[model samples]
Target: MSMVINKQLPLPVLLKEEYPLPPWAAQAKVRRDEEIRKIFTGESDKFIVLIGPCSADNEDAVCDYVSRLAKLGEQLSQRLMLIPRIYTNKPRTTGEGYKGMLHQPEPDKAPDLLAGITAIRKMHIRAIVETGLTAADEMLYPENRSYLDDLLSYEAVGARSVEDQQHRLTASSLDIPVGMKNPTSGDFSVMLNSVTAAQHPHNFIYRGNDVTTSGNPLAHVILRGGVDKYGACMPNYHYEDLVRLLEMYEKRPLENPAAIIDVNHSNSNKQHKEQIRIVSEVLHSRNYNPKLKKLIKGVMVESYLEEGCQTIGGEHIYGKSITDPCLGWEDTQRLLYKIAENC
Candidate 1:
């Protein structure tokens, strides 16, 4: 057998019991959820800024960043809705390297899933309780969602996972807003098909039981551009790309038609610093065609306390990213203020 059995980790339910969110924090999560869901429904005009480190590798750094966001949020409360991108489980194409906080809570330590579950749950609770700001996390592992479900306000399906059947089905069940990204292949129809599937009810086997989802009307599209067969990046965040996506929505009966542009990834060709210019261009596009604003809801940015990335090992910088490179804290702040101004 290729696989070896490690000790079984406790179920999500038991973990939740062990690290329960405070009553006040739970209330805060509900309020945050309501505010974010309205953005998809077009009930609010506030722009969303899903900004944070590429992967949340350290707890202290994450909390420190969120605390600053909390203060900034108070300043831009009327114009912007900031959601910390506290992504814990990162998808690896080759299935090697540091997976994320879920695989190893400590960057230099061995994998301890039990500790990981506890660490993530506690960190989310602390973010909510301390800052009163619920977060957005990628649903890299559908089953693991139950572990943080109570605290998360938004969920995203990455470009790689957008085409998977389980991802679509699971999105249908989530009551919160779910952003389905265009697949790595850059197929528009594939992404729209996912949104359609997620917006409709479905019956599927999940977690050892038969379940039926009520359908998620808030399910929408995310344009992170794409990669081609030749291993080159292809962008889809241009003026034409937004227009085409809007046209696609016009042809479908999907509910609350909206799209969020991911400024990094294939769109920026993985150039981290380009996120600043990308955000400006997207805002300009939204402003140029007032109609496009209906479809272009916001942009996702990868940023951290430091400007670039460092490999995981001994003597790591306190707040720099360990995976993909990211914009430093100073740049992140200035860009956000500019976004608020533009919006």
Candidate 2:
């Protein structure tokens, strides 16, 4: 064989068996799950906010961030349903750079799949137990999702992988809310088609077994903006763009015609500081139009204990981002309070 077959890590079942959630944590998860699902089903008028670092690079920092968010969530429970983002797997555009904690638990160390897996699981469990918060992680590797699916409350299919057959199929099987982002080309049809595929039943081979899924009704869309032919970012989270998406959704049969705007990606042209302005503009649009508010369920923000980003292996800041620039804790806190007031 050309590639080496490394030793296999424990399966998701065995891992959970060994480190199962406590009864209290499990009950908390159930309550949080329903609360989040209600937003997708339109049963709850509260807006959902998925905010955290771009990737969970450090367990201590990530846990601390979620702990603070958990406190804020309690106070804003009536207006906002905050789900901390614990994205462990990052998709590199050219298959390079730090591929998140799942690839290398330590930023300076070499890749260790086994250790990475254990670290991610432990980090997620700790967040829930320590803060009573359920998180949202990207489904970067469909097969790897099984490792964390039981613990995640929300999932996202990144723009690069939205059209993949395996990703769509795996999303179909998930019971929780899954957000499918528009491709880099900004093709809404491709994203909507993925949603359609996810919201209908399908049978596919998975993990050496034939698995059939009844389909996930909560699968929805995420607008992360797009890149132009000249490689410039073209945002699609504007009022007109949202109206266009609403028209498209009206034609589709997807159960929950909703979208969550990603404020830090191409939408803000990767300018992390633009996140605050973007949120304010989107909120203004929601306030101006009733239909738009009904279609936009939430916003996804990249934030951490510190602002901006640093190259990996450099003099790293304690809570700054390693993958992308993010909003600092103070600004993030101010923005959250503002959003609550608007809500």
Candidate 3:
């Protein structure tokens, strides 16, 4: 083997026992999960917003940002459903760069997988106990899902991992909603196939056990735009794009048959400020077409305590992102209120 054997780490059950959730937090998670489920099942008319930093690099800053969002959720209770994004693991295109909190809890520190696991679990627990919000996370490593499975109410199968067999199978076994994004090459068929695979029964080898999953009905699509053959960003958040997705959904046996528009990524061309404008355009499209309003459940926004991104390995800004550029809290709050009024 090319890799060195490391010490065995604590399993998910042991870790949960070590840092168990409080009674209030456990009850809150149940309520949040049910509300989110209603949104996917077409029983709720309120819009959903998955908003937070691109990478949760700091414990204090992430909790602070989500605490503010939890308050906003209270203010916009009737119009929208807010699920903070506490992404602990990040996907690197070349297997380099800071791999988020799961690889390095501290941006300037060296990689420590053991400490990273504890830090991520503690972060999620704090977000729920203090703020009463059950956040979302990306399934970067399928086997690592169990670590935060109880703390998270939403999950995302990133564009790069949505087509992977393990990701699809793992998502099938998950009880939470999993948003499968279109591939980097902009292939809708690949995204659709992933959703189908996730929504059907599967028998696979997982954690050295032969497991059978009853399938996840909440498996759905997320339109985060895509990259073209020329390496340019191509957007699919327009009215025509959504209309095409509805057509595709009609042809499939998917359960929920809904999608979420990721306002960042290639859709905004990494232009963080463009997120607000893109959201406005999409909302306008939804209003113009009644069909679109039913099909698009919500949007995903990348925002933080500060605006833009900074390079790692220095005394960087406290709340700015170490990965991708994100909107500041002021802009995020403004956009949320605007969305609430419109919704």
Error of 3 at 248 (Å): 0.5
Q: Which regions of candidate 1 fall more than 4 Å away from where they truly are?
A: none
TM-score of each model, paired residue for residue = 0.98, 0.99, 0.99
Q: Write the candidate numbers in order of decreasing lDDT.
A: 3, 2, 1
Candidate 2 or 1, higher lDDT: 2
254, model 1: CA deviation in Å? 0.2
**For model 1, how does the per-residue alpha-carbon lDDT over 1-343 read when each residue is reduced to its tens digit?**
8998887888888988989998888888888899988888899999999989999999999999999989999999898999999999999999988888888998788988888888888888888888999999999999899899988988999988999999999999999999999999999999999999999999998887899999999999999989999999999999998998899899999899999999999999979999999999999999999779877888899999999999988788988999999999999889999999997
RMSD of 2: 0.8
Which digits, one per residue and each the tens of the lDDT, describe model 3 over residues 136-184?
9999999998889889999999999988999999999988899999999
Lowest lDDT 10-residue stretch of candidate 1: 290-299
Which pairs of residues collide in model 3?
A: none
CA shift of 318, model 2, Å? 0.6
